[model samples]
Target: MSEKKEVKDQFIIAYLPDLDNTQTIINNAICFAKMLNKGLILLYISDKAYKCVSITDAEILLKELSSKITGIGFHSYCAIEGQTKDIINKIPHLLSGVLLVSATEDKTNAKVKEKLASNPDIMLKNLYTSRIAYFISSQNLNSNLPFNKVVMTIDNMRESKEKVLWGSYFGRFANSEVIVYYHNYKDEFYRHQLHYNIKFVMRMFDNFKIKYNLHLSSNSKTFVDYQAIDYAKENNADLIICQTTKNKSWFEELFTLKERKVINNSQQVPVLFVNPREDLFILCE
Candidate 1:
């Protein structure tokens, strides 16, 4: 009798909306899975309940694809038949984990993209469950993986710690240097908050012996997210770590524009958006 292999509880979910357009998403997912030493899930969501791909076929395809990868510990496929909203709502309960990877470019129409950009609730409906999401941009379709440099943006908010944690985590796993960029706040209250956040990040990195650089932005007029993205582009950074919108009213969330710009930046640097929550998912070694 043969023994079944045990998979790790922490894994990366790569959502593939179309089988024909799987290369970019799969490549990026494999890169992350290998770098982080986590299992990989090739997930496909289909609205055709009766005509969706069968488990047998999906498994066969998954096996063929997995054969090409070298170091991934475990890999599997999941085909869900449901509306987009229903599937997004059920994902966290079914696959609670540290990270989710999805490509930003889809086959959707222009109107849909515009709507999603303006309304972050619909665009990132899944991350509200406190899942860290990495959205691969189209400009980085062929970029190399195992990021060499990671840029993290900090603001005058408690959520800044989450970005720091993720940036340090990536530095440990991928051996990438982290750039901590903070906005130059002039308000006394905001400046005090930023100081504490920067102090905490410095202490954490110093204790862990992670390689990092601090960059205090002089351009106070520009949005922090845009500044981080610009710095990453100019410095040849492979990834940017930032937080999603938090404590916003319905109107603010509906018109949330920073994340949309960062995700679709012309520089094409990949973004890892960490949602602010009391209980955020942490990756285990």
Candidate 2:
């Protein structure tokens, strides 16, 4: 048998109704679907949710999950598998021929709650369902935006340009102008060197003819982590993109009440953090 190829359909909603805000999930999914001209897949991760349950129970629970969203002339699929996310994950191979509607989520909170601080969720419902259910919607569905601009934030770019190189390929593919922001303190010793680096970065972007923007930071006065957030603000960005590999350790500087104050105050524009292979290895070469 031939392997299935992923579908290229522009927008797809992959929903898990067993999540919180069931009503909101349904509402958002439908709204997004209509807004984006996309298809819907209502998946129930029967056996696949976690490794603890039996298959029989999984199927029963999955079907009873009631993850439904319907609209006139809309293409919707319903599946009660051992695990919903698992099937959704293998969709690239399973639904190979057609285009796929992928759902991406981050384990970290996008906006830190000022009062509650940090604590993990206990319920399966609270953890992933918020966006999973919306994946079924029409409003926040896959983007049709021309992707005319992209941004990058990093500590240093001395040796390896792998991260930027990868980001460039993506921006080039989308035909968007790219901005690379290097966030560091303006120490007296490296003041001159900072200017040179900015010039070099500009040249690299210039060669690509993609039209670039560069930002330099010299001191902790502005906070090292907050410059990108700040630059992203003054520019009024359409999408805030970040790249990382492996898990990032939270820094004391970042987690502190003072630090969170800085980041939390940043713009509310949606952020997109891309996880590329080069992030973990520190392509400082």
Candidate 3:
């Protein structure tokens, strides 16, 4: 049998209706679909029985969402499964041919009281393990603006170079300029490390020929993620690209907390998290 490749190029937006940012997610997904020249798939995983009592209700909601948006039409899928299991079992199959754009709720004191932070970590792990090109859209982002300025944040991690390459790919697709942001610890001992990181990132962008600016933040002792976000916002970034760490052990815990901060901040921009190990096979095809 031939490969079922039709869904491969679709852009999946995991929509949660109870969340206030449903429209933002849809709009962001639409913009991304246009930028990537891919189809849009609006997915809602209904965990509550009351939300979608029958398949008919799911279908109706899908149509309602589709009618509100202009330009590209949406392919809708709603799975009546538990949220945890739904993410684990259905996402891999549903996202077989498409990239994922996760519209997650911004973390706030209210959400914390409601205990929503733990779930986002689970979703993050599932997406990372799937090794797909995925992004977490800021709940407050203005998706209407063009992706003319993209910011890629680089740390000392080995995969930082790959993040730059992915950033360049996105930059080219949107016909936008790429800005590489590197946060260097404010210590003289790390000065050489900063230079090394810059050289590596530059080499990755060498062949892409996409206009890019390299910005370094050297004086920082606390709030690393905040500094990165502040820099992106200062430069009027439309999209921010960063790499996702494997969800395991202390590193995963720290990364999840740090990333959650970046995603929920006042800087409302889509943050694309690429798995460094994943090859550029999808892009080449």
| Number of the top-ranking candidate, with lDDT as the measure | 1
lDDT of each: 0.70, 0.40, 0.60
Q: How many backbone clashes does candidate 3 have?
A: 2
Across residues 1-285, which tens digit of lDDT does each residue of candidate 2 receive? Answer: 111223454233444434322343344444434544455443334443332334455344434433344562344444445444345434434432111222222225567432210121112122221121111111233444334565565543233243455345435455666667665555754545545556665566667776666655555465433566567667754344443223334453234433233323335333333333321211111
The CA lDDT at 41 in model 3 is 63
Candidate 3 deviant stretches above 4 angstroms: 1-10, 17-21, 48-56, 73-80, 85-92, 106-130, 185-197, 220-224, 250-256, 276-285
lDDT of 3 by residue, 35-141 (tens): 77665666655455222234456556666776676776444545344554445344545554346666665555363444342245545644555445676765565
- CA displacement after TM-score superposition, residue 69 of candidate 1 (Å): 3.0
For model 1, give the RMSD to the true fold.
Answer: 4.2
- Poorest 10 consecutive residues by lDDT, candidate 1: 113-122
Instruction: Give a tens-digit lDDT track for model 1, residues 93-164.
Output: 566445777665532335543323113234455344444454545523775576889888888898778778
Query: What's the best-to-worst order under TM-score?
Result: 1, 3, 2
Clashing pairs in 3: 7-97, 8-97
Q: Please give the range of 10 consecutive residues that has the lowest summed lDDT in model 3.
A: 1-10
lDDT of 2 at 46: 41
